[model samples]
Target: MKAVLIEADTISSAWSQLIYEIYKNGEEHKPDYSMSTRRLHATVAINDVDNNQINSFVPFGENLIKKYKEELTEEYAEWYISLPDDDKRKFDYCYAKQLFRYGETAYNTLSENLKNLRVGSRRHVGVLWENEVHIPKFEDQPCWIAYKLELLNETDVLLYILYRSWDAYGGFPANLPAIVEGFKKVFREKKLPYRIESLIATGWDTHIYESDLQAVEKIFKIAQLCPKCGNLTPKHALISTTKGKVCTQCKCRM
Candidate 1:
């Protein structure tokens, strides 16, 4: 698998660059349990979490982010308990459910740790997957496995997340901002002085599905990297004609 690293000032740029890199260099992977995809191991670091911008290229918007944020922070134990037994078994896992009401006793990993935060607590982390429960399943498993909050300085904290598998195109846009919002809410409620300095996300099997390839290409058609200079040229700077597209930066024909 190809391993790629991206550092950006905002989430939009990081996600855009990630898609471009995967489109350029990702290898085709066919897993028996899921759909075939163009996959890469991606690690993205966003320097400014507060400046996370939603990309207009994708269909995702603010409403989706808000919904995901609520799902991440809110507890749904009562709803789950009200469901029928068969339905409960069918709906095996939810990220919020696992993080807040995990196991039979409904242990709240995130709130419990935040409630007990000390002056120098730097290892506050949340678990979303239990090995004993999810190891046997090949499908319907959680992509987001865990997250950690580490103190970077006296007034800044870094949010680091890990995913066993991720859908770069569909999931990356909304999921990231929602998680950040959820964390921020808790930190504020706890009266913590630390602000989230940055966010680092690692996706072991980061991929774009085969079905979304054309859509991804369409979104980036107006803007593409120059073949010679390898710099992403703006749409207005590119010269498109009946013959082919030309890069104004390096004058490379595509």
Candidate 2:
């Protein structure tokens, strides 16, 4: 499998390029573990973590993005406390639970790591998967596996994330922003002086599922020509609204 590398100034751009590259270059494959998909191995670097919104022609909207981010930043225990015992055990492996509450005591991995960094502990990595917990499961396993924070030159912090698998069409837009929000929450709480320099994400199986092929086609069709500017642009570079579609460059509405 060829590894594709994408470097963009924002998450929106990275996701846009990623989906287009997969649509253009990926090969169709049926994995034993999951649904058939057009798959690629990809590494994406977003230079500005703050510019993480998906202002594109994707299916989902900001509400879904906000929910995903809340799952990362909010405390799982607080939410879990309201759930019945059976319900809690059945839905045990959300990103929130794994991230904010891992292991027997529900150790807060992000908080612990931030605290370590504050006191000058060299460890900045957080593990989201446990072999004992996740290895036996074929379903409900986390696509996201781990994350690391790298402090560079005492000025900026770069976040590196790893995913066992990623759904390029349905998952990428929401996931990236959520991860960045999670880290920003920690940085703010810890009162870290460093800015988030970039976000580097690697996915072993970055893919668009067969079910989403039609939607991908629609996105490409919409991107072919800006209705207002009449210039060719990718869908990610344009913003769609109920009133009209707007070109990012010319800001013309149609």
Candidate 3:
């Protein structure tokens, strides 16, 4: 088992560093399911959740942030997860709604407790997994397992998260911000003065799918067309090509 720890001031910075770290050092291991992916474990801590500029890096629609943000709430979770047991079997994928909703939602419990804003109370925790409904064999399950908040002071709230599984490329970016927003909502509803002091996320199995390898390479590639000569060169290099010495900018390349 390999462990990676990343600490950054913003979600974007943390995400960028973690991606590069995994690409450089992650090991390849076959998952239980038939998928082209390997697993790695890492812990990431971000000091600023409000600075979410890294959302731009997500190839998918930015709307996914909103969608994931909703998923962190009890209302959305309850709406999607109210199906009866027999009806739940009809769905192929197990939704997080089941974990966050139908079960005793952590948000509700946390909100109720925060009314008093008691510091150093270990009870400021929320659970997502239910042994009876989830522990039994199922095709898919929620990757996020639980969340806890520690009121370090009257104005600082520290968040801690546990993930049974994590997708570094796609899931990590969205999940972190959304969880922060979700917790912020809890703090706001309680009318308590608070700042997201710090957030720590731990993943038991974090990985990227093999199918996305090429996309990852392109993201970090340094080669780009020389602005002047139109010849490909390392983005930051002065290259001596048949066309002549090409600089990073058009005038030098031309």
Question: Given candidate 2, what's the lDDT at residue 252?
Answer: 45
**lDDT per residue, candidate 3, 136-254, as tens digits?**
85556667877777889878888888999888888888888777877787568666688789999999988878887677677669544333433334555756666655654445425
How many Å off is the CA of 244 in candidate 2?
25
Give the TM-score comparing model 1 with the true structure, all chains together.
Answer: 0.82
> Could you give candidate 1's per-residue lDDT for residues 1-254 as a string of tens digits?
99999887778778778889998899999989778999899999998877736765655668887788787775444465556777835475777677777766788777776665554566688878888788997677888999887776677878889999999998998888878877788778778776878999999999999999988888677776543433345577767655555556345433
**Model 2 lDDT tens row, 1-254:** 76899877777777778888888899899988767999899999888778535745656988998888887765644586457768835475678777788766779887777655533334688888899988998777889999887776566787889999899888988898888887788678778776778889999999999989888887788685445533336767777766566667656423
lDDT, each prediction: 0.78, 0.78, 0.69
What TM-score does candidate 3 get on C-alpha atoms? Answer: 0.77
After superposition, which runs of candidate 3 have C-alpha atoms over 4 Å from their true positions?
Answer: 53-55, 81-107, 113-117, 223-254
Candidate closest to the true structure, highest TM-score: 2
Question: How many pairs of residues in model 2 come into backbone collision?
Answer: 0
Model 1: lDDT equals 0.78
lDDT, residue 17, candidate 2: 80
Lowest-scoring 10 consecutive residues by lDDT in candidate 2?
Answer: 224-233
